[model samples]
Structure formats: structure tokens, C-alpha cells
Target: MPQRSAVSSATETERKYTAADSGSLPDLAGLPRVAGIDVDTVELSAQYYDTADLRLLQSKITLRRREGGDDAGWHVKLPGGVDTRTELHFPLDGAGASSDEPPAELMNLLLGVRRGMPVSLAALLTTSRHRHRLQGSDGTLLAEVVEDDVVAVRGSDGAEVNWREIEVEIAPSAGSHDMATLFEAIEQRLAAGGISRSFSPSKVHRVLGDLLPAAPELAEGARYLRDYLVHELHTLDLSDIAVRRNEPDAVHSMRKASRRIRSAVQTYAADFGLDEALVDELRWFGRRLSPSRDLEVQWERLAERVSEIPVDPYREATKTRIDEYFSAKSETARIEALAALDSQRYLSLLHSLDTLVDELGKTLPARRRKSELNPEKLAQSVAAVAKNVDKRVARVLKADDPHERDERMHRARKGAKRMRYAIEVIAPLHPKRTTRILARFDDFQDMLGEFQDSVVSREHLLDILSEQGHAAESSFGLGILYRLEGEIGRQQAAHLEPAWKKALRSAEKLWA
Candidate 1:
């Protein structure tokens, strides 16, 4: 087998400032810590890579390979919290360094963002740097301040630009609170000398100039629905990246984003003249993600419930069975989810969404435009969805057969979900009222969800028990689990009426 590519990670916390050609780092000889300073200089050259459309730069991410630097190698930078970025470094080795393509290891982490798009050289930059290491009296490094003169050449147009900047980065040894104070002091000190923070997030962003899309802003002619669509699209992008990173709640969040967009489209379908095909595709995408997220929820719930079983051997056997089954199934489901994300269908869906957002943002003659959103009409639409949910709930209540009621309850839960999503779409227009209604609906939904989960759990337990197994103890344990789920389902069903009444009361506030 080929050896795995070596990788290391670091978090960069720094502020960048632009200055005049003659400007440079100012004096800090008598700052708060009375630290001594050490100075050094280095030269560096880096080749940045991205898709032809500069997708990475648009997302505030960067991929590069640098030579002549102490940490020379391939690097991937991801936007983090305020004034911070996470950097992953891969050593120059094997075919990765010699070849033009980025290493497979680093590329895998960006699968969500790139979505199988090809990456190529975007820009080349060289920097001449003067570095100052600030240290405490005891020789502990507090921060590193650097002054850089940078020259960049765009790979596309052979356009060259040169500038000077300063960076102040907090050292690992510095306390978080102390670093905040020190950074502010540095900022104020620089301001006194006519230096200010750069508007550009990175060198690549500045270099790309007009090549990237303009960041969306709310201004005149901006429709609320258009802004909402943009926000959901961005949320989908972040969720995609998180899913690739295998981060917690990534699959769940992505599914939620997909659902919100789909429901928003449906809620405004008549007004916007939106395409039904886009809604269908969104549903398809969410369905592809459902297996992984559903299994994840089931596993956590089962494992937690099993842990509460105080009995020995039976408890242990039940726990082991749940763990083994879920582990195998979750892995398979995750593989399928990733495969879906890599599919051409997914790319087509994204393009459709992009086109829809673009059309929504345009200004057109009234005759050409489909319609505009009116808050009163939107409230009526929301009420219609909620009324449908109420009908489903009534059907569940009227069902005499247990199996039929269970099925009807599941359908009611789905309707409730749709109603909640519709309310969320118009939430910005009436935050207080929508917030109240949503909270109540959430409680109602939770009860229904619990009942539905129990139904699924019982089915799973029955299947496992029917399978041939060695120990009577294991079979008995699964039998107990089935009984537990059955009882919980009954209890949740009993509680549904009260939850629905409470939700109904709060929902009235939407139009009141």
C-alpha cells in the first residue's frame, strides 16, 4: 500500500494592515509587557491554486505551495472565527511535491467545496519579509510582528501588483485575554501612524480583483426573499464543507438547509414563478442525505436508552448489538451520502439553485415579473400549511386501527415539519410572532418525532430479534428493548393532544 501523506495543522490568529510604500512596522519598545524584540528577515514564494472560477477564493479559502520558507510545503487555509484561520500543512514529498496537482490527502478535505471540479494554478506571489519576535522579560514569546513587501502575478492575465503590509500574530504562549488586549493596543498604535486594516481577507482575494463574485449585500431593490435565498445557499455551502470534514451535525444541518430551501420555494411558488423541478431536485438531495442522518439519530437514541438498562449481561449484550449494527450501517450510509454529493445530479441541482437566485434578484417590468411577496398573502399561505397539518393530526386521532394511526401520526409529523419550515421563511418579517409560533410547533413536533422514533426503533428491534442469534440473553435483551419502545410510543401518543393544543394557541399569534 502507498504510504499516507504526512500532514500537520495549525491555527493562524493574525491581523493584516496596508500601509504606504514608505511605511513600515512602528516601535513597540515599551508596550504593556515590557517585552524585548528580536528581528529577522526571510524571502518566500508561493503558488496558489484554485478552480478556474476561483471557487476557493470566493469561499474565503486558499490552497498554496511555497518554497524558500521555514514551513515550505502544500498548505490549505480555511476561514475560521474572527481574525483567525485554520491551516493544514503537507510536507513536500513523493509525487505530491513534483507534480502540479495537489496531494490526494488535502484534496479529499475540500471535496465538498470543489465538488469534483478541477484545480489549477491561479496566482504566484513572492514576499520579502522583516520579522520581529516580541518576548516577555522571562523570554516567553508573546507575539510575532512582520512587515512584508509583496509582488503578485495573476496566472490568467499576467497582471502584476506590488504592495506593503504588516501582520501581528498572537503566539501560542500568549493568553487569549492578554492577546486581545495586546492586539487592540497594536491596532491603536498602528492607527496613530496612519496604518489601517486591509479590506481584503487575503492576498489571493486582492489579486483576483474582479474575477470573483461580488459579496451580496442588502440595499435598495433587494427583495427579502432574494436575500433569504442567498443566506440559505451560503448555509448549504458551509454545511457541505463541514460534511466533508466529517464534523458533528454536518449531515443533519445540510439536510435542514436543503429542506428550508425547498419549503421556501414552495411557500413562494405562486409569487416567484419558481420551477417545480428545482424543488423536486432539492427533495432528492435531502433524501440522499436522510439515510446517514436518520441512522445517526437512531444510534444515539438507542445507545443512550440501552445505557439506562441497569441489568447485567442483558444490558451489555443489547448495547453491543446496537453498537455493532449501527456502526456497520452508519458507515455504509455515510459512504452512500458522500457518493451522492459527488454525483452529477448534485452539481446540476446546485446550478439550478444558482440560476433561480440570480433570476429572483433581477429587476424586470411588472408584465415580465411573476409576482411580488405580500406579508398578508404569505401569512395566509403559512396558515394553509398549518391547516393541512391539523387535518393530518385529526386523521390520526380518528383512526381506530393501531397500524393506521401509527402511519397517520407519521404523516402528521411530516406536515408539522413543513408548516414549521414555512413559518421560518417569513420569520424575518415578523420575528416576535413567528418566534413564538415556532417554539410551540417545535414542542409539538418533538412529541410526534419521539413517537415516530419509537415506531422505527420497535421495527428495528423486531428485525434483529428475528435474526438467528446465539444467546438467549441477547434475544431477551432485544425483546425488552422492543417492549420499552412500544411503551414510549404509547406515552408520546397520549401526550400529543396537549402539545398540539399548546402549539395551536401560539400559532394564532402569527396573524393576530
Candidate 2:
């Protein structure tokens, strides 16, 4: 087995300006800080890698191994907010680093977009960099500005391009407001020197421009669904990276993205001709992610419920027992969830999702032209979902038996969730009409969610009670907690009628 390099990640925010090869450096010794500037020079050689089709580049992701800079190593840069990118770094001399192949772990981060395609050397860039550090009077580093003369060669054709670009990057110490002002000042100064902002996102992008993917053009009618699907796919990709990093709330986010994609696809199935098999696979993927997020939510909720015990000793005891119980459960669930994500099934699902998005983007416009993707037809479909939710709500209210009511309640919650997501997908078309309706459904779904949570909590508490080894005090506290969850469930159930009624009232105006 090949040893993988340890990876570290950080968010980088920077702006780039195209400059003429012979342009003199702009004088920045009198910017906002008006202090001395520190300057250094470095030579760098970098090898970029991506799929044969440039999948990573098309997704605005870049992977490269560079030597000669202070931070020389293999780097993966992920797209972030405006003028920002999240960078993952691996040491050059780390175990698997000798080969041309990227570290397996870092490559894994690209799986969502790579879709199991083999990556190869895409470009080679060599840069001579003049680095300038702008500083505060007390020697604080405010920002680093670099003038890079870069030569890039395309790996496929060995076609070479040379250019000079100036990059301004804010330091961690730079205040947000101050950084904005600083960038403005620097841009003005650069503009005075005849430099303009670069159109290319990166040096490699410019070198491989002809091979990059083109953005799909959507018809007016196809725009809403297409945009929503694209946005969700991007979220899923980002969340996949976050999960691989094991960042906080990563599993929850990935799960929610999966749900959003599944919901949107299911809701708009008729309009887009999405595959049912893909939906089933999405369901399977989401189920795999559920255990970790479920355990986390249950633990937090039960820990909070412990405070309602009203006795100091019992509350603390209950808290400790719940915490300990959930700690073990959460760890196991997290390990399982990550393992599932790392499996081949998850990669296949990603590939299917990628295919779906590509197909939709390419076909929706033509479908709209045929009137097969009518907005009214989409509205009617959502109305059908609303009707189902209403029927389920009615059943929940009329059920007499406790077990039947419990079963009916679960169905109602699921129905409400589907309705809310349906409205969310179509809200762009009827924003004014759907805003209040979505709010009501949000309230309805939240109440149902709490009720369902209590249901699950009570079951777990019962299992705890049936076990043999707990201290009498701990069990006593848990017993009280079990009862409390039952009471809470009843309270939530009672509130359900008014909530659904409010949601129904707002929904009535949706198609009006």
C-alpha cells in the first residue's frame, strides 16, 4: 500500500491583474498603510493534472505540484466565494510524492467531479515571481502582491504560452473592510499603470482554454430548473470535499444536498425525463449518510431535553449518560458513514448525477421549445404534491389508535417535507405567491420534524431502559427523560393541526 501524504487546507482570497511583460512595477510604498515594503523573488516549476476531458478544470478546480516556492508541494484549489479559493496542500517529499501521481487522499477529494476518470499531466507552468509584502508601520504584514512572469505548456500538445500577471492577496491580519479599501487602492494604482484585471481564472486555465468545457445556454423556460439543479450539484460537490476533510457539519450538509437533488429531480421528473434508477441511487446514498447525522441530532436533542428534568442531580446525571451513550454511537456512525462515502457505490452515484445534470442542461432548451416543459405543467405537478400532503394531514388528525396515529404522523411528516421541497423548487417562478406559502410549510415541516424526533428518541430510551448494566441513578434519570420525550411528542402533535391549517391557508393562494 502506498502511504498518503498528510494534507492541510486553507482559504485563499486574491485578485489578479494582467500586465505587459515590459511594464514597470507599480509604486505601492504609499498605499493605505504608507509603511516600508518587503520584497523577495522566487522561481517555480509546477505540473498540473486533470482528467482527459479536463473535468476538474471545467469545474473551476485546479490540481498542481510545484517546486521552488517556500510553500512548494502538491496543491488542490477548490472554488469558493468571489475572489476566493480553498487550497489543500501536501508536502512534496511525503511518501507517495515521488511519483507523478497525486496523493490518493487529495485525489479522492476530487472524486465528485472526477467521476472516477484517470487523471494525467494537463499542463506545466514555470514562473519567476517578484513578491512584495505591504506592511503596517509596526511591521504587520497587510498583504502580499506578486508579479509573476509565467510560461505554461499544454500537456496534450506541448503548446506554450507566456504571460505576466500581478496578483494581490490579502493577509490573514487584514481586516475585511480595510482589505476592500486596500484592494480598491491597489487596483486604481495598477489601472494608472495600464494594467487590467485578467479574464482567465488561472494560468493553467488560459493555457488549456480551448479544451475547457463551455457553459450551457438555457432557454427562458428552462433557466429556473437548470439553475437550481446546477446549484445543487455544486453544493453536493463542495459538501463531498468537506466530508472528505471531516469538517464540522460535513455529513449533515452532504445529506441535505443529496436530499435537495433527489427532491428536485423527483418533483420535476416529468419535465426533465430524469431516470428513476438515479433517484433510487440517490435515496440509497442519502440513507448511507443518515446514520451520522441522525445520531448527532438525537444526541443534541436528548442532551437538551435532560435539562427539563427539574432536579439538579438528575439533570446532570441524565446529561452525562446521554452524552456518553451518544459519543460511542456517533463515532461508530461517523466511521460507517465515511466508509460508505469512500465506497464505489458512492462514486457511481456521483457519476449518475453528473450525467443527469449534463443531459438536462443540454436538452432542457429543446424540450422547452416543444412545449413539453411547460411552467403550468410543473405548477400542476407541485399542486398534486400539495394535495397529497393535505390528505396525509387529514389522516393524521382523524386517526384514533395510538399506533395508527404514530404511523399516520410519520407519513404526514414525510408528505410535508416533500411538499416543502416541491414549493422550494418552483418558488422562483411565483416568488410573491410562494414566499408566504413556503414560510407556512417551513413551520409545518419543522413541527412535524420535532414530533418525529421525539418518536425516535422515545424508542432509543426504551432500549436504554431494557439494557442491564446502567446505574440505578442513570436509569432513573433516563426514565424521566423517556417520559419527557413522550410528553413533548404529545405537545407537538397537538400543535400540528394549527400549523397545517396555517400552511393550507397559505397554499390555497398558490395557484390562485
Candidate 3:
């Protein structure tokens, strides 16, 4: 309901290249399952727009209004990688299709990037394209290879530039075709011609390189932690986008990102200026996301375990109760979480994260070289987390009473998660060893998670029975459900020991 009209979007996955050699054309003819290569050509023109300071460019995003070819209108491209971008399109508005002013909906999508900055015309590009389409035997389109001759003019500066490149666009929705093989074969043909892949992100980047921000100069410890923080922030942003679209697993993914961000700051706070208040705020954000995610987990779990209940009118009544509760709780939780994300508070938090790396870079900018990394110091910092994991795991293993064991295992799970995230940060430094250590502890954490879930499920099931009020059949069905959950818990308990031992041994070796 944010927009009156639908926001049309698709994943744009394509590779751009400069050359494909001169001597002989590659065998781009009919390959396996391919019907033929159909050739055609077209002329395309686009006007790119952005903030005066190039805020959108800094974020590797582009908003353009174009004419010609099959798809035309205003397009917003979010750069994901060398060949991946999330593209959203809106039909051209009648008032000013080529006006400096952007559509209101497109402006809304760029709020996270623009942060209230004013936008204007950045550049204009025109291309004469010769396209080759690969199609399947049944006339299904596969990929489009286009040779583009381009001319670009900067809007403000009046500077002009031109270039030619080959762009291979795989039909992202097509999975039945062997696109990967076709891509590799194309690359091989180009490689044989002594053509190298283009390094520029896009034609716009090539023309306006001076406007983009320079890479941060960072210290060794700062480098590791900065990358960790940026990654978590990226996940956080992506998850928020998914949640806004009402996509699956968005809340869970967002929660995990918040947790990872919190853990990273806790593990290496001094490297950045991360303090206690900020950590508390992250925890607050995670808590806001948790209610929705937990309700989702409970709803799915109770439905799954209903099979264990004895088949009777009691079972039917329980199912109805569960459904009604789930419907109300889930709707409220979703609304609450979305409301928080759209609040000014969340927007301010995002703006703060926008310059997180550069701000950290200023802390210890003196050491720019790899030789400055103190291996012994790095090892000690890593070992501190590993030691914490070991202590928690040991407490869980030693606990005798059920209550004591559950409490210890809960602590152990949190510690293990923190350690696993820390290891992932340093995995490139010690890939083989860290990979082994991570797997062992991850298994241990997952087992404890299942055990804890079973405990909560049992209580919630009992609450359902208690609400039935004087119904004998309901009590009997609830008893069966509770016992089944207890048995499941026992099964998980049986699977825990070997994983614990394996994790303990691996944790010790990580420090070794």
C-alpha cells in the first residue's frame, strides 16, 4: 500500500565485456539443446540521474529513464556484483518522462541511499546495439549477446566520452537451459581472442570515475572487523528490503544480521569506536525483530507436532485454537516490526552505518600495510573467544540436574554462535583449521537449539490444554502431545555428546 501502483522488479544478471578477438568468430552457433542464434539490432538511449554529491553512485546504484528496445521506462538498478543487479521498473509518467525530477515512487526506493539529498540529471548515454539471441529448440529465448557502440555526455560538466563493449545477458528466469555452459563457452572463445573482461562496473562508472569515493585505508585489525561490520550491515539492509516485500525468511535473516553485528562489535569494539550504548541499541533492534520470528517458529512447530496428538474432537478443537492464535499474533507482529523499520529511528541508524567503515578507518590509519598485522596479537584476540566457548561447553557437559543442564546449554549455544561468527571473520587467515572448527561447533549449537525449542514447545502445548477448561478428551490429547515432545527432546539429548566432544577437541585445536 506504500505505492498506488505495483513496483515491478526483476534480477538483472549479465556480463559485460570489451572485446572477443579479431581472427575468427567463436562457434556461437547451435549448441546442445539450443535451437539457433538469431541476430538483430536496435538503438537505445538513456538519461541517468543522481544526487549532486553522487550519493547513489557511491552506493553503486543507478536510476535511468530510457527509450527503445523491448523494455523501456524508468529503471532503478541496484548493483549486487560484477554481473548481478536488482532492477525495478516503473512506466514513464506523462508529465515529464525526460524531466530532471524523478517519479515519487522511484524517489521512495532511493531514500536509504539519498538520505534527503536532492537529485538531478547526471549523464546521458546513447547506444547503437547489434544483438544476438540464443534460443532453445522450442523457440524459448536463452541469452542475448549485444555489441554496443556508446556515446555519453555528463549533464553538469558537459564532458563527453564514447566506448564499445559486448554484453551477454542471460534470461534470469530461464533455468531449463544450459546457460552456464553457454557462458563458459563464450568466455573461452573471447579468451582465445586475447580479450579480457572489462573492469568497469558500467559505462557510467567508466565516464564518471572521479565522482566516486576512494577506498578506505585501514589497519590490519581494523580491516578484518570493518569488513565484518559492512557485511552484516549489507545483510541487514537486504533483509529489510525483503521484509518490506513480504518475502519469506526476511525476519529471521534480519535477526541473524543484528546478532552478528552485535557480536562483531562486542568481539572487536576497541578496533572501532563501538561502545556499550550502541551495543544495547543493536540488542534492542534484535528484540523488536524477535517477537515476529519467534511467533512464526512456534506457529509452524505446533502445526508440525499436531500429528502426535490423538485424533478426536479435542484434536480438532486444539487445531482451531492454534490457527486463531497464530493468525492474530502473526499479523500484529508483522505490523509492529514493519512499523519500526520505517520509523525515523531506524532511518537514523541506517544513516549512521552509511559511513561506518570510513569512520573506523580514522581510528588507526597509521598502519596501512599487511606487515603491520601482529599475528600473536590477532591469535590472542581469537583465542579469547574460543576459550569462552570451551568454558560454556564444559559447563553444559558437566551439569547433572536437568534444570542446570538446560541453563548451561543455553549459555553454551550463545557462546558457540559468537565464536562461529568470529571464526568466519578470520577464516581467510586460516581456512582449513577454521572451517573444521566452525563445522564442529555449528553442529553442537544446532543440537542445543533443537533441545531448547522442544522445551518451549512442550510448555506452549500445555498452555493449550490448560485453556480447554474441564475437557477430559483435551487433557488426554495434550498429554500425548507433551510426551511426544519429551521423547523428541530425549532423541536430541542422545545426539549431543559426540558433537560436544568433537566441538571441544576442535575448540582446543583452534587455539593450538
C-alpha RMSD values across all candidates: 3.2, 2.6, 4.1
Runs of candidate 3 exceeding 4 Å displacement:
1-5, 20-28, 31-38, 50-60, 79-84, 93-110, 113-120, 172-174, 189-195, 271-273, 310-321, 363-375, 386-408, 462-479, 490-501
lDDT of 1 at 360: 68
Which stretches of model 1 miss by more than 4 angstroms? 1-8, 29-36, 94-99, 135-142, 172-182, 215-222, 363-371
User: Residue 409 deviation, candidate 3, in Å?
Assistant: 3.8
Residue-by-residue lDDT tens digits, candidate 2, 258-368: 887787788778777788787788889888889888888898888877877877877787788788778888888877887877789988888887788778668645444
Q: Write the per-residue lDDT of candidate 1 for residues 157-211, one digit (tens) a residue.
A: 9999899988899987887879888899888988988999998888888888679
lDDT of 3 by residue, 50-156 (tens): 88878777667788888899877898887675478988887775333445567776676566457656788899999988888888878888788778889999988
Give candidate 1's total backbone clashes.
Answer: 0
In terms of lDDT, the poorest run of 10 residues in model 2 is 364-373
Whole-model alpha-carbon lDDT for candidate 1:
0.82
In candidate 2, stretches whose alpha carbon ends up further than 4 angstroms from where it belongs are 1-5, 175-177, 364-368, 508-510
Against the true structure, what is each candidate's TM-score? 0.88, 0.92, 0.83
Q: Which of 2 and 3 is ahead in lDDT?
A: 2
Error of 3 at 275 (Å): 3.2
- What's the CA error at residue 247 for candidate 3, in Å? 1.6
Model 1, C-alpha of 345: deviation from truth (Å):
1.4
